[model samples]
Target: MISLPEDQPRRISEGERDAGVRRLQEAYAEGHLSHEEMDGLLQQALTAATHGQLARALASLPAEDAGTTSAIGAVSGRILRRGVWRVPRVLKVESALGRVQLDLSRAVFEHPVVDIELHLGTGRAKITVPRDAVVDIEGLRAGWKDTLYRPRRGAGSGGPTIRISGAMGMGRLKVRHARR
Candidate 1:
């Protein structure tokens, strides 16, 4: 017997929901998502209207390769790489070891404010912006130098203002901008 709602979303199977949760978890653990972004994306995944939507959401998971391939019905069954995250280009980074690596090296942030909040253990960080770019670091355990906020000349003349906040336990954060 096939029972489905006429208008609203159909209930997804436990397998689909579980898979979605796994995907969401992987994104966060990989630093691919900021706290808020993770919340939003996970919320969407959990509340997805249907199984189709849930599947789509999890389909874009980053490729994980290693001795990571396991045979499931003559096909791979691994849902995630051991540590690979499917993160977007623009993002907020957080870590417990205080290690935040950002490659803004190629991204010309057109926005006015680029805010970053990091929670870490050792606090090692870096950022590359346009030379004209301005950076404001607050709520951090170390001073400005600990964060190598550099701007690449004219490239930063009208670039965005990048802000970073770090927790005491954080590690190093590295940011590299795109080369001209």
Candidate 2:
């Protein structure tokens, strides 16, 4: 066995801790950890003082995927995305006075967690997710109508997690799970 010299513990920065927290959230969304477990890990990550502590908080998580982000913007027209499309890990959608529809029931999800940030203005947006998908729209802010979404009862059937955020101006968002 090789003998190693004792070294000082490296302190982690706030950004590192924040990244750990994000990883925990993704793990929780993917059903890899229960809510309580995620909460505990989140607390640990938030209070982590060293790199080892932060690493422990993020331990046992799935390997990070090399996913891509794409942005879609439209002005005064209809933006529709259906058929067999590849869903990016992060999607930024911006529309001005245009209707937007994204049907992901038949789309390919390359990542375990996906984030969709929408910045809409005076347009209606409809999103169709897979039946087994887990969606969290708590970060979305609507200036007009309340979002139309029915939460799925019980646990999910194990699919990707979609996190939607950003602002909607004078628009209504309707999210529905796809039906067979």
Candidate 3:
């Protein structure tokens, strides 16, 4: 039996390789990579013995295709998104008499700029982002008694840019950095 290294990179499995290959194919189909380049990356992904190698094989591909997601939190309910999930380019969140939380510290973002449209109706929404991420809240509109607390850091610098917009009526919206 052929044994692989126990290192983190070597722990990559065949499923990961397949996923990398699929990403390369998608990049090729989207015209980001040529047929020859796709084939070469596909070969590298297939033979990748480590996670690092697999990552390098698909590094040139775009993080996310152009897509959007709509999340709704109903009355007396909670909606949360956390962990190492893929983030959509555009996210629409609506909360009514409930709480909605989106944690992006460990998420894999698909785009460098994430556009978030939030509608809070007598509800609360909290967004936790990475410390290095840039946040823009210029488009936020709040009603009387509606409050919004953002990170201390200014926008237009650092890693990804999260553009937050929309309205809050008798609700609260907070954007804070995740604790390292």
Candidate 4:
């Protein structure tokens, strides 16, 4: 039994349990855990009654994936990533005649610095980051409109640093703070 500090147990919601299960699945797919280990963890996650128990079940897993990932938006399509998704160390986003939105407000970042390489072609791309994160936009070529807004204080030293680069042809790229 997991011990709680205040003796008052906090109920674990279904969403939280599902998220834990997804993380375990990802770990298993990435070869980070064996099939037996994943089965055990999934059982614990499904039966976890309290927040503390759920946290204990997921405590041994890594915060994010071990390597980089790429998300592509093809022509006339949309690609969106939000909610409690994991942010990779290096993310490559490409959109051609489509829209792409990456919201990192509720994301989990394992790396201190996240590099995003964008390749937009006649499409719109928006990246919404946390207020505390440091955003650096560079190497934006011509024919692209930049609507990135930053705070006066800049990113905190301890916060994650997001470095955005690459080219956008006749496209719009915007980066702003998350509302929440």
Candidate 5:
């Protein structure tokens, strides 16, 4: 039998279970697993009470690729990225004296988790996320204005998660989910 490290958790957490299910779904979407196989493995991941069961459910899957990181900087003009754009795993956005708008409703996300690190001097930022996206903005620090965000009820699960961080000086950050 295979043995795990002593520091490894025995019980499975909700986040871990959710991540396992996401990996299974992504594998199925990418044609790596058949429908029947995906369904069976998904059941195993869902009903897994221990970490060992969850690991077994996700065994034999393709490893995740090393996603890329990109940067966008604007000194005095507007920085807008809307429509169908490819999203990287880590995006660093810096603006000095204009508005920053990122509409990710129709964007193609390459990774399951996207991190947006904003370093704004005085420009406000507006981000429109996907309908099924889960957003986390705990690491953000607003100097003068509060972040405008409202979590909607009934948001579907197993979608890509967006993590927003960094410092916004004297500019408000507005985030909203897509309507359609």
Candidate 6:
């Protein structure tokens, strides 16, 4: 990082922001960020609404060599309207020394927003939006697990909303939710 002298103002470049994103993404992926924390940070980067935010994400993620990552999710109104969804749609349902089952599903919304519901059982779930579209989501998980969902507010006004329900061993649902 470069600091500005008292006599002058400091200047930041787009490269620096990219560096931040790299760092952030790596940290989160590497298990450094709890699900909730990761979701919050990801939302911040997506909701940046400016080059500064995008740059920050690029810079925060682990520094990668040139030709590293193809744009995973860049904001685009067109994709939002299309309501297309790709990989990382997983939900776990059980957790214990024995076994568990979690179900994950999706439905076309009246709008672009994408919602998510996760019934966590025995793993870490991951997904990314390939386009910059509205994102809306609510997740419920169970059994000594954490279910976190964070989307750029207003981004997924009508995108997608996910719900999860299940139990951990002893037959008690740890997480449950249903949207009318």
Best by TM-score: 5
**Which wins on TM-score, candidate 1 or candidate 2?**
2
Candidate 1: list runs displaced more than 4 Å: 1-91, 108-110, 143-145, 148-156, 170-179
TM-score of every prediction relative to native: 0.37, 0.67, 0.59, 0.58, 0.74, 0.25
Superposition error at 22 for model 6 (Å): 38
Q: Residue 19 lDDT in model 1?
A: 47
Residue 124, model 1, lDDT: 58
Order the candidates by TM-score, highest first — what do you get?
A: 5, 2, 3, 4, 1, 6
Candidate 5 lDDT, tens digit per residue, 29-142?
Answer: 999999999999999999998989998999878987759999999897999999999999999999998899999999998777789999999978999999878888988999
Clashes of 3: 0
| Pairs with steric clashes in candidate 2 | none
Using lDDT as the measure, which candidate wins? 5
Which residue pairs collide, candidate 5?
Answer: none
Q: Which ten residues in a row have the lowest lDDT in candidate 5?
A: 151-160
- Report the lDDT tens digits of candidate 4 across residue range 1-180: 977777788785454565577778878898888889898888999899998899888888887554676565576688899999888888888777888889998999876668888888887888888867777676555375765566535444345677788888887888887765
Q: Using TM-score as the measure, name the better of candidate 2 and candidate 3.
A: 2
Model 1, residue 145: distance off in Å is 8.7
Task: Give the better candidate number (4 or 5) by lDDT.
Answer: 5
Greater-TM-score candidate between 2 and 6: 2
lDDT of 2: 0.86
Predictions in order: lDDT:
0.51, 0.86, 0.75, 0.76, 0.89, 0.37
Q: Any runs in candidate 5 off by more than 4 Å, and if so which?
A: 1-17, 25-44, 47-63
Global CA lDDT computed for model 5:
0.89
In model 4, the runs with Cα more than 4 Å from the true position are 1-66, 152-154
